[model samples]
Structure formats: C-alpha cells, structure tokens
Target chain A: TQLLEQSPQFLSIQEGENLTVYCNSSSVFSSLQWYRQEPGEGPVLLVTVVTGGEVKKLKRLTFQFGDARKDSSLHITAAQPGDTGLYLCAGVGHSGGSNYKLTFGKGTLLTVNP
Target chain B: EPEVTQTPSHQVTQMGQEVILRCVPISNHLYFYWYRQILGQKVEFLVSFYNNEISEKSEIFDDQFSVERPDGSNFTLKIRSTKLEDSAMYFCASSDQGPYGYGYTFGSGTRLTVV
Candidate 1:
C-alpha cells in the first residue's frame, strides 16, 4: 500500500494568516485529491490534481501536485475562521492492477482563530 | 446538489451482535464505497462496489464484514459480529465514474459504537 505522510499535524493561526500543509509519499500516484472534514461530518472533496506539476486554485486555497506525483501541498492565503477543519490528502493508483482504493494521509488539523 | 445519504447518525450495539449500516448513494452514480475512521485517525477504505460487485476491499474488511447493494439506490454494510475495535465513523461514498475519475461524493457518515 502507498503511504502518504502529512506534516504539521496541528496548526493554530490567527485569522488572515497564511499557512501551507504538506503531504508527501515515496510512491507515485495517478491522481491526488484534497478534502476538508469538519467535526462529525464526512470529508468534503476540495480539489483533485491529476497531471504532474499541476496547480489548481479554489478562491484563497491553492493546491499543487509535485512533478514526481509523489507529493502534494495545500496553501491557504489569508485563512479565515471558516477554513478551520481537518485537511486530508488522498491518492489513487492502479499500478500493476494491485491497488485501487483511495489511500489517505493522516490529516492536518488547521484552526484559524477569529 | 445531489448527495449521498446515510441513516442512523449514531448506533450503539453490544459486542457479537449483528449490525447493519445503510447508505443511499447519488441517483446516477455507478460506483459505491465504504470507508471507516477511528477517532483521530486517517480514513481507511473498507470496500468498493461497482456493477453490483465488489471491485476492491482492504485487509481490514475481513470475514466479519460484508457489503451489498440490495436495490438500485441503497448500499449497505453488515458486520456479522461486532467487536469493540469496530467503533468508528463509517462513511459511504459514490462516484459516477471509476477509480480514475474524480466526481466522488461522501455521506455525512454513521457513527458505530460497539460495547
């Protein structure tokens, strides 16, 4: 199984501050996705990156996929209180038809204090 | 927007009892999945069903667990016998496309507590 390592398990920042969460892995993936989960709720899909070196933006949130397809990052500019939640990175690969599920990373808990 | 729906927001059952978690995937979705997360842990995939059959399953989904799409709209996960370690949030998700596609939607989840 492919393992995704998410860094900075917890982040507490004042509103309007910028933050970046990282998810790294040694195995390449065919696609990478980011999801935000609130307390007591299932994760909501934020974005998916398929191409290597691809970058996608959702308002103040910027997501990037590494050229090697082994790492991804989520950068929030001027974070708001509403952005406070658990951020997760998941990857999917079908190499040699051996794996076909979304392998998730241990999430990064971000708290944007108001 | 269309969404996946799960019932029994929370359930508490005795160990060794049979428990069933129900889900209603989006109307048009063709692929359905079940995932679980222990408190403060990463989400773990349990099984994925497509074309009325299981496409994939994790080792964690052993003989005690089973999944079925009884009707066109409902997907269910059954635990033949529950264990204390089975306590966790169970999420159901559906996708219009296969694993390679991106339009996956997840339900709010059902919290199962085995005592």
Candidate 2:
C-alpha cells in the first residue's frame, strides 16, 4: 500500500510565526495536492504540484515537491489565526485503466494563536 | 465558484439500519468519488464512478455499500446494513477531468453516527 507520512501531527504557534510541514512517501506519484480542512467539513484544495522539484506560492503559503516526486512540503510565512486548520497532503497515482486514486497523509493540524 | 452539494449534514441511525447519503456534484464534472474519514483518522477512498459505472473501488467498499447516479446530476451512496464501524464523515467529490485534470472539488460532507 502507498502511504504518505506527515510529520508534526500537531502544531501551535503565535501570530506572525513561521512553520513548515513535511509529507513523504516511498511510492512515486503523478501529482501531489495540498488541502486545508475545517472541523465538520470536507477538505478544500489549496494547491497541486505536478512536476518534480517544482515550487508554487500562494500568498504566505509556499509549497514544494521533491525531485523524485516522493515528497512534498508546505511552508507558511507569518502565519495568522486565519491560517489555522488541518493541512493534508495527498498523492495521486494511477489505479488501473483510467482511474486514479488519491492517497492522503494523516495531516498536520495547525493552530495559530494571536 | 461551483460547489458539490450533499444532503443531511448530519445523520444518526441504529445499527443494521439502511441509510442512503445523497450528493450533487458540480454540473460540468465527469468523475465522481466517495470517501470517508473516521474520527482522528486520515481520509480514505471508497469508490470512484464514471460513465454510469464504477471505475474503481477500494477493499473497504464491500457488498453492503453501493453508489448510483440515478438522475443526470444526483449521486447517491446506499449502505444496506450499517454497523457501528460505519460511523464516520462521508465526503462526495468530483473532477472535471480525472485527478490529473483539474483536481477534485469535495462536498461539506455528511457526518454519520451509527448507534
């Protein structure tokens, strides 16, 4: 089974602090996506990395994919209370025929306190 | 922005009872999927539907569970017999293309509590 391991399951930081979360996997995937989920709600897509060693930035959030497509990371700059949520990383892989499956990481719950 | 819609934000049922969760995917999406997340656990894939048939399903999707796109837009998940273990947050999702296409748009989800 393909598994995505995320580090620092829980994190709490003061306002304006910076944090980085990592996601690693032994299996290679065609694409990796980052999502943020609120309690009692489904995950909302944040970004998707399709190329190896690629980097994308969204406001204060920076996302990077490993050269081998086996790992990814999310770095938040000057995090605020609004950035607090469960951040999840999911790897997309072919699952026979035209079907593709997403294997998700356990997730990193971040709490930004002002 | 378009959103996927799910009915009954919360559902509570007795064990062994049947329950059908409903969803309405994006109007233009072609690929549909069902996923579940147990409390304190990661989200897991249950099944994928396309072209009026199931394209793929995980081992967790057994005979007790089924999915259908009865009309042109509504997607439904039916559980013949619910068990305590079935309690979880069920999410419905859709994508314009496949995962490689435009990624996925998920619903708010239905929290199922099996007693």
Candidate 3:
C-alpha cells in the first residue's frame, strides 16, 4: 500500500503571501492529483499530474510531480482569502481494467486571512 | 458543472441500529466509491463499486458494512449495526471511467454520528 504523508497539517497566512504544501510517499504511483475541499462540500479536483517531473499550472496555483513519482507539491502564489481550504493529494494506479482507488494524504488546511 | 449529490446531510443512530447512506453519481459515470474521514484524520477508502458489485474494499469495510445500487441512479451504503466508531464523514464519489486512472469527483459528504 502506498502511504502519502502531507506536511503542515495546519497553516495560517495573510492574504498576498505565498505558500507551498508537500506530499511525500515511499511508493511510486502512476498518477497524482490535487483537490481543494471546503467545509460541508466534497473535495473538488484541482489538477492531475501523470509524467515524472511534470508541472502544471492553474492561475495562482502551480503543481509539480517529482521525477521519482513518489512525491508532489502545490505552490500558491499571492494566496488570497478565496484560497483558504483543505488541500489534499491523491495517488492512483491500476491493473487490467480495475481502477485502483487513490491513496490520499492527510491534507493541509490553509487559511489565508483577509 | 455536474456534481454528485447525497441525501440526509447528517444521520444519527444508536449503536445497534441499521443505517443506510445514499448517493447520486454523475449521469454517465461508470465507477462509484465510498470513503470516510474521521475528524482530524486522512481520508480512507471504504469500497469501490463497478459492474454492479464491489470491486475493492478496505479492511475497515468489514462484515458490518454493505453497498447496493438498487436502481439506476442511487448508490447506498448500509451498516448492519452501527458502532460509536462509525461516526465520521462519509463521502460518495463517481468517475466517468475509473478515475481515468486519474482523479475522482466526490460528493458533499454525509455526516454519521453513532451514539
């Protein structure tokens, strides 16, 4: 089983500050994904990174997958109050037609104060 | 802008009572799953259903738990007898095609409190 360990379980930052959250695992995965969850709402998909050493961007958020496929990171530039939420990382793998459910990190709760 | 939906946003039950949590997946999704998160804990996979049956389940999903898709739209999780440990947030999710080996779209969770 792949276990993802996320750092900084709780974070508090002022608006306009930048932050980076890390997700690390000892086992390699075929893919990695990021999600943002708000209270009472299920997690919403943020980004999926497939290739080793791949990088993807969405406005203020930037995601990177490690070359070893065992880690990933999410960097937020000039964080805003809207960015306050629980950030999660999930890793995926499969065999044949079976879609292996993701192994999720505990999560990083980021609060960007306004 | 489609999303999964769940009913009875919160449920409270006695330790020995039966409880069923319901979910509505995306219109065209082929794979469905159930996950749980204890307060201040990581999300844990409970089970994944496809082809009308369970495809995978975690150790946490023991004899006391079961899943059924009685109709075309709703997915349900049943606890034969509730336990205080069962209290947590239960999330239902769906994927267009097995997470595309990618990510899953989760529904707003159902909070279950067992007394």
Poorest lDDT segment (10 consecutive residues) of candidate 2 chain A: A94-103
- Candidate 3 Cα errors over 4 Å, as ranges: A94-98, B99-103
To one decimal place, how large is model 1's interface RMSD in Å?
1.6
In candidate 1 chain A, what residue range of length 10 has the lowest lDDT sum?
A92-101
In terms of docking quality, model 1 is: medium
What does the lDDT read for residue B10 in candidate 3?
Answer: 98
DockQ of each: 0.66, 0.68, 0.67
Top candidate (DockQ): 2
Candidate 2: C-alpha lDDT = 0.92
Better of 1 and 3 by DockQ: 3
Scored by TM against the true chain B, the candidates give 0.97, 0.97, 0.95
Model 2 TM-score? Answer: 0.96
Decide which is better by lDDT, 1 or 3: 1
Q: Evaluate residue A4 in candidate 3 and report its C-alpha lDDT on the 0 to 100 scale.
A: 87
Clash count for each candidate, listed in order shown: 0, 0, 0
User: Residue-wise lDDT of candidate 1 within A3-105, one digit each (tens)?
Assistant: 8999889999999999999999988888889999999999999998988999999999999999988899999999999999999999888343323478899
**Tens digits of per-residue lDDT for model 3 on B1-115?**
8889987799999999999999999979888999998987888889999989999998999999999999999999999889999999999999875643443789999999999
Q: Which pairs clash (backbone N, Cα, C closer than 3 Å) in model 1?
A: none
